[model samples]
Target: MRTTPRRLLAAMAALTTALLASACGGGDDGGGRAASGELTMMVPLFGTAPDPKGEVHQAVEKVVGKKLKITWVPNAEYGDKTNVVLASDDIPQVMVVQGKTAAFVQAAQAGAFWELTDKLDRYPNLKAKSEQAELNASINGKVFGIYRVRPLLRSAVLYRKDWLDRLGLKVPETVDELYEVAKAFTEKDPDGNGEKDTYGLIIPKWPTPVFCSASPYNVIETWFGAPNCYGDRGGRLVPAFDTEEFYTANRWLKKMVDEGLVNPDFATLDSGKWNDPFVQGKGGIIIDVNVRATQLYGLLKEQDPDGYGDKLAMGGNLKRSDGQKFSYPFDGYNGFLAVSKQSVRTEAELDEVLKALDRLATKEGQTLLANGIEGRNFKLENGYDVPIDDDDPAVKTINNDVDFAFVQLGTWATIGMGVYESMPTSEAERENLRLRKELAELDLQTAVHNPALPIVSPTYVSRGATLDPIVSDARVKYLAGEITEEQLRAEVKRWYDSGGAQVVAEITDLRAELGAGGN
Candidate 1:
């Protein structure tokens, strides 16, 4: 999902303060060294936790010169569990904290975490990354965590080239053309199945905040000239839904639903099930992360060995009706790492932890963490680190399954962009990466950045989480024809009366303070 400072803050505020300060504090004095070179950590697991006894884990421990203890919380429950841990003051020495969370802001304000602003300069690798990302991660203009670098834009339209070729259709270049393509894909039997079972497009039930890569709403909204999250209106910052363009986009999507070009149950469809139709050859298009093109290709080929799965292609950003192209811009960092004073206690221990993290940013550290033991998981072949075997137990043990353990400290995009470049063994894989990189670069040129990104709104911290669902649900209902346009407008008005107005005011004030102009 596309996470924002406001959303993270809201999730953080859900815990009770009594629970946060109840745990026993760390035993270290405010020194720069830990008595024992042992570090404890807690991070959200994107998949199953890696075996601690695995070669990758052992390799990381050897590089950092410390014995490690880590708790891998599932992503779905991470926010709540993190709250419980923070409330108990029982956080690990190193913990993953959403830099924009309210709990973290409150903790930082209360001196519960170290101020890394001045300390970051000492670590060359950490300081050399994006200064803007560090700014985005700051609270009250002070840095308290180390940001994990991510791409600024990764969204695009992925379609079935084989189907398009069979139908004698070219890649759509405009909003109207996209609609026509979807219509044809749905009714023209592009799959040659001799049945009307395919859909033109696949849409999620609720698509906003542009968080998930699969959310087509954001890309579709761009076509109607809507801004990302918040838009500029005559020097005032306003919620995107407050604009006429957003309403137009909603009506456009509703037309798709009414015409049966999109999945009928999309309003209530689970996100996990969103990709099933496309992968099973029942859908023709999807708007998602460019990397999914590679993944979808693999799945398609596996499901139909001789089918046209090999003809999937990535499409460029389509031009809006106004003749301009735009894509949503992301805050340029993933979740950041913060050291808890309740765990580390002393400045020395914090420094010790920081040093290890700094090492992880180096070439030696990144290579080891990304590829694992060179000879074990991969080997130098013609100047490239090639995978030994896709099915090898050792290879699987040291690959990305364990990357979550050590790669988060400071992975630069420059280092990661070459990941697909160096490892893709097939021409198809190479083409996917090449197309992804090309689209990302193009998106960069037309990205509409969120002006409220660094601005913190108290209204949002208190009511945003609640109001977000109200707006999202309303939009979904309106698109599904469950609600009228007038009712949709009323809901938007209700949102403003509730707290959206305050959010806009805070963002507008912050924009003025930062010397930024609107409209």
Candidate 2:
């Protein structure tokens, strides 16, 4: 309803005609230009855009055997810019689409982009794909983009080992133990300054309560046996909040708040400063991605190098009271690189583009993008790449180029993309990497995925913005003790009455049509 095919077709009639004409009116090969050694791409820039003359850029060009013309749009403005580009005639050859927005879905369905579902196999590196990633990125059961890869099981509990040692509390392996540890951390003066100024958890105000990915609350919910976002109930797919496990998890989290174990301002605390409490020794626990442990360790080491060792500890998802482990899983990809049909014009051009991307996924190409020129950006230290300090002006520019440009184009996280290993020089780094790998493998065995991730529900899309807040607001109210359990149930029923029931029915039928089994 929000973005009907009819509406999109009407809105894009002019642009669609232009795109078709361009594709048909190109050169002899039907490609807009000859098979030049140049490729134009658009990507979101999270930091300052790198200088074009930087060494890293040149290194990447040399490795990929192509002159790269990158349009670095600020991340915040990328979505808007993408919308504009989707409606214009001057589209880039390749673009990094952040998500399958309604406009993007319409554009893709209208054949604005090349469908690479069967084409990826021609390139070995690009052909290596994760099943979960493919499922999440598909549009109408077809692949339109080469998805960027991420870890499938990225959740972990981060805690302060120093605080635990001082209080004689062991690392929590179960939800009940975690509660007890949190209580002790809050009430037992774990800081040992003879003052109770610390709390157990450092939960910030989550960005959205609907998606709930990466939220500490979501971690607790999944550990309590709730699904990641949606759960399959008797062949019926429904939102996770509709499950009994979600209710139980909410009650448990509310208990923590009522007992003053978690940060009081968790509802309003900025996520940007979520680590500040841990750094200031005001909190001792953070349930987040495992990679955060390495980052936190680095920050602590920067402040106190000698004492930072063994000061931090990491763990995978905790077990429920029944000793069953369940994990919150990432979608295994960020976004994807989509090639434009108008720009590519022909299958041969598409092949050339895919080949270049395949090369980027190779070991030599990945190393160049990630580590830069060996002697310039890093030095071989005992056969391991040791990054050079960026204090020098030249090194700083290279580092910026790495972060702001080359790294953004990396697909190294894709399974079998290429090997880009670096040895850890410190105990913290070693353990962090070890646990990251170990926990990822362990959690994957028990990860719970959302069945509705790939489903296209018209009702949900149109009414989702209105429908989600019903549960999200109710959950917040229940956590704040402003509403009773009965009130929360009533709110959920209200959601079903409004539009959620229709969403459930549609998703159930669609799942059946797609032959998607239970989670």
Candidate 3:
């Protein structure tokens, strides 16, 4: 795939082990003469981002009893940059990669990383959580990386509940009813603006014709009670793409296109473009990713203030007409952080960083993860983080400085499926939280959204070269009707013929070997 995280920073200093020892190994770490040094971190942030510092960094320093100097070399073009780093004997202390699965495996085989499996006990937090989760974000049955945990909720249909109520329409749970509601949204102007300028629904654009990459087919596919991309049946791995239910979904989409119910350019609409119709008050029914919904709600309030502020109501994953919910989670996220072989000169120091991560995973850590500091970042208003009270000075500091708050800590990643409230506000946004929780429950209730699918790491390594074009070509042709169902099958078969099948087969074998064949 086209590697990201590489086009981050090119201006990095190369250091020898001697420099690292002098800089980080000999210093007052966490009160004792602990290791005090600087190490380069291949952070997700590019743009000359300094190494970890301040309270968050300090907390980590405390955990490890060492001072860590961080240099961020963004994930924008991460995979290829990492490849470059790997070939050279000199590299950063650490690299948190996005899609480096194959690269990691290849690197491990070449003795490119510090195998931390036996050493994990040194840090109890990492050990417990990793063990707790059966932490398998590794290669060859050995723990090769530290996985960051976040919510696993995805694939649910959201509708304007208030609109349905206003029109005396029951929230649809069947294919026929869903179409009817979408049609009414177009014909009825569910927003009650007294104008029929609104369409009923929207489906975000899917990339097509070149590579049949998975896109937002769940909204339609789920309505048919079938998984669009992947799902589970009897705890066995399955592709809903092969089912007649999928055909029903496609047929429904075709009809929607013919009737102008869903946005015509849905195949091209991403979060940005997809939500435009919703924000402009031009759509009633819209299908969205979980995180995008929160963003859309915020934008609507900002754009119109009065229009969509409280007007928008979100919901949990909708049940398919067949009582099944489409699970959209993709093998969980591949945010495992790995230590480079070049950085192993100071494994003890690196262990400290892992310790800090372990702490952040706890309740106290979760508190800081949610609210920065007690009085500075946020204050507890009825057991909720409220920054709008102005009692904290760090609110602005965090707002400006803390970009990693969402990812490093758990809050951002877990913000959906229920926590979409007014953080640091007087009253929790119950409606927001409720909608998210409802959706979360829907995901949890569904047997599909697999939490343990040994999904290949989304690294921008080798697979993309072969995988991308096929997905692009397939997606485009299928949506454009240039390819019939037979064509789609032939294309999928080509994935097998051209090694995608082999890839899947390999993954299947690996999962089985791991005793995780339960997919």
lDDT tens digits by residue: candidate 1, 36-70: 77767887776657788877778777877787787
- Give each model a TM-score: 0.88, 0.91, 0.77
On lDDT, the candidate that comes out on top is: 2
Candidate 3 regions exceeding 4 Å error are: 1-40, 46-60, 75-77, 116-124, 127-136, 191-196, 207-214, 218-240, 303-310, 345-353, 360-370, 388-395, 404-428, 449-463, 469-472
How many angstroms is residue 443 displaced in model 1 relative to the true structure, after the best TM-score fit? 1.4
For candidate 2, give the lDDT of residue 493.
93
Candidate 1 TM-score versus the reference: 0.88
Tens digit of per-residue lDDT, candidate 2, span 1-519? 111111233344565565555544544432554177888899888777877677777777776778888899998788778877887766788888877665567668777788888888889888746877787677655788888777778889999889999888888989999999899999999888999898998888877656345578777888988877778888788777788999999899999999998999888899999888997899999999887866687789888888987678888889999999998888777678899886787778788888888988887777776666677767776656677776788888886776566676777542122244466758677777877889889889998887777676766655666776687778877898899999999998999999888988997888888787767
User: Which wins on TM-score, candidate 2 or candidate 3?
Assistant: 2
Full-model lDDT for every candidate: 0.71, 0.77, 0.53
Q: What lDDT would candidate 2 get against the real structure? A: 0.77
Candidate 2 runs further than 4 Å off: 1-30, 413-425
The TM-score-based order of candidates, best leading, equals: 2, 1, 3
Kindly give the stretch of ten consecutive residues in candidate 1 with the minimal lDDT sum.
23-32
Cα lDDT tens digits, model 3, 380-440, are 6666655654544445545333334323434122333212234522122455555665766
What's the C-alpha lDDT at position 345 in model 3? 46
- TM-score between candidate 3 and the true structure: 0.77
